[model samples]
Target: MTISIAETAETIDTPVLPTTETAKPANVKEVLAFLVSQYPLCFAQDEHIKPLKVGIFQDIAQRLGDDSQISKTQLRQALRVYTSSWRYLDATKEGVSRVDIDGQPAEVIDAQQAEHAAKLLAESKQKAAEKRKARMQEQRAKQPVKAPVAPSDKKRPNKTLVKGSKPVKAAPKAVVPAAKETIATVAPALLTLEPAMLAVGNKVLVKLGQTPMPATIQEVSLPDVTVQLGSGMVIKTRQDSLYQA
Candidate 1:
């Protein structure tokens, strides 16, 4: 096929830069999702998301090229969301291989990288917890105050006359209802868990690094028991690690 002079001139023209600065975050999520669909082996959603190889951004830009529908800025932003995710950080353990854009294994995550990821995950979780607690406190504060409930009336003692020169009535006294007493129950100092005796929701003290922690059973399936610690972290452990609490 013969090409016209105008066609050749048009092909030689400079390419326009992608306009992604004005792109919204929702668009970035859509872009990330598209990437996930294109490379399911490399990317995922929720807790299944995996850690990516270092400098995967350049690899993606190089592969997608200028012809790709999404802009480089949007791709970079989407990558930021993916690699910095909680699941990604959690999965970035030492000795675990980081996957390339095609899901092929690349470099193994090192000790420093794993530790850094762990620290980030912890800080993120702590921030989330603080936000939730703050919201709960704000909600409680907004709630209307309830009126105080009056104490229920009780029967007065039978009147008895005092012996004197003449009949004298006993002195009248004010009577107020006593407050209800709540008895505190302490857990057993040391009690081992038996398969037959343990059930879901049972409170147990599990030693973590030589320190006994109070936890409540969330699930019970034979040898493994899932417990929620006082700090609200849930973990699975064997029956031997638990004691009555």
Candidate 2:
């Protein structure tokens, strides 16, 4: 199957090939190509590729549940390849719409999903670059290394030629730096709170992330509570997400 993923834009498409009536796909690539052919609108190659809906594999599995030719394992693999493709990741940016089985718009991708897709694409590119650099280094290492040439007689006219002298020692090769190591750090946990703090008009700290912001509880519905943040922003969240002010 043809897979041309560009740096600026991803290109993942192949010429549609005829499928076997009885035999299963020989490999995952073949399976993906077949999937593209079956759902041309949902799955595409080159620049036209779009992001599939979340949990799309389950939907596809249910739809093609009766098809004996394509097994569930291969179908899942194909979907993985399609979703992880550079073009697909590129299309999963924020504000892009995901497509359903019939190629209809399912939902607009949110910022979280878009950020995750971008991270995956960056990792993929970094891996590819590392592999390419390794290959180049290997090729360079394989070629014959030339010996250092001796100084010409005219250039060293003041000094006599020594028969047993060794050619000038080649300068030492530059040392390669060690790969960076990731340092893991822990974030402080949220402050504990009592159940009574969930009442209306009670000022509590809402955990937005690592930092908690002060908000006055406006309404209490057991686990769900409505509060007005210190910034004048209103939000609804679970009781567990709040802490004592």
Candidate 3:
């Protein structure tokens, strides 16, 4: 096929940049930044790096073409040089470990390093648990243990007058009137009394003379009958106004 003149001209005019190319970081600072951004948890966990494990710093520096500018030994030394500047590498035993980018456990550090770190972590936790147990035991020891009170030793209630305090006299039982005289008194206005008498949270009931009314102790006052009847009717009156069932 004959190539078009416009296509040939366009191809010749446009010199495309090579795609198989890698850019190097400007300096060591840039290399450090890139590494930290890429692998934040490089030196985390028990503050120790494991043997035979790919260190976080080296992997990151190599990926960004910065490793060529520095020697492997030098790079390793720089990474091992722990300082506050490397905030991303803050070691913490409280941190949780999951799979890293390589699908391996994050805390899967050098075997020797991990063994030592694990031992330290276990010792700290053991000390804390022991402290808590000791504190609990101390509290239990300080508590007053009540002996079982025998039924025979229990003091029986006596009906005797005290030297100074007045005796608690029993209330007189309410007299029951004749059945023929007992009758329900009709109310004129159930809501005529003050709402304060039937305040919320108080229990009360409504009665008509000796006859038992369909009522419930929905609310009451200090000396008043403010009741919401079982039939949903609200009434307010004096405690002496309604007779008990």
Best candidate per lDDT, number?
2
State candidate 1's TM-score.
Answer: 0.52
Ranking by TM-score: 2, 1, 3
lDDT of 1 by residue, 1-245 (tens): 22222122122122222245444334545666667766788877755666798898888889878878778877876676566666677789999998898899999989999999899777777766787799899999999999999986997658655666576577778787797796656644677766665788878888787567999999988678889999999999988899877
- In terms of TM-score, the best-performing candidate is 2
| TM-score of every prediction relative to native | 0.52, 0.55, 0.22
Worst 10 residues of 2 by lDDT: 2-11
Model 2 residue runs over 4 Å out of place are 1-11, 14-19, 154-245
All models: lDDT?
Answer: 0.73, 0.78, 0.46
Shift of residue 201 alpha carbon in model 3, Å = 99
Put down candidate 2 lDDT per residue, 13-54, tens digits, no spaces: 553354665657776666766777778888777788888887
Which is the better candidate, 1 or 3, if ranked by lDDT? 1
Q: What is every candidate's alpha-carbon RMSD to the true fold?
A: 30.6, 30.1, 26.5
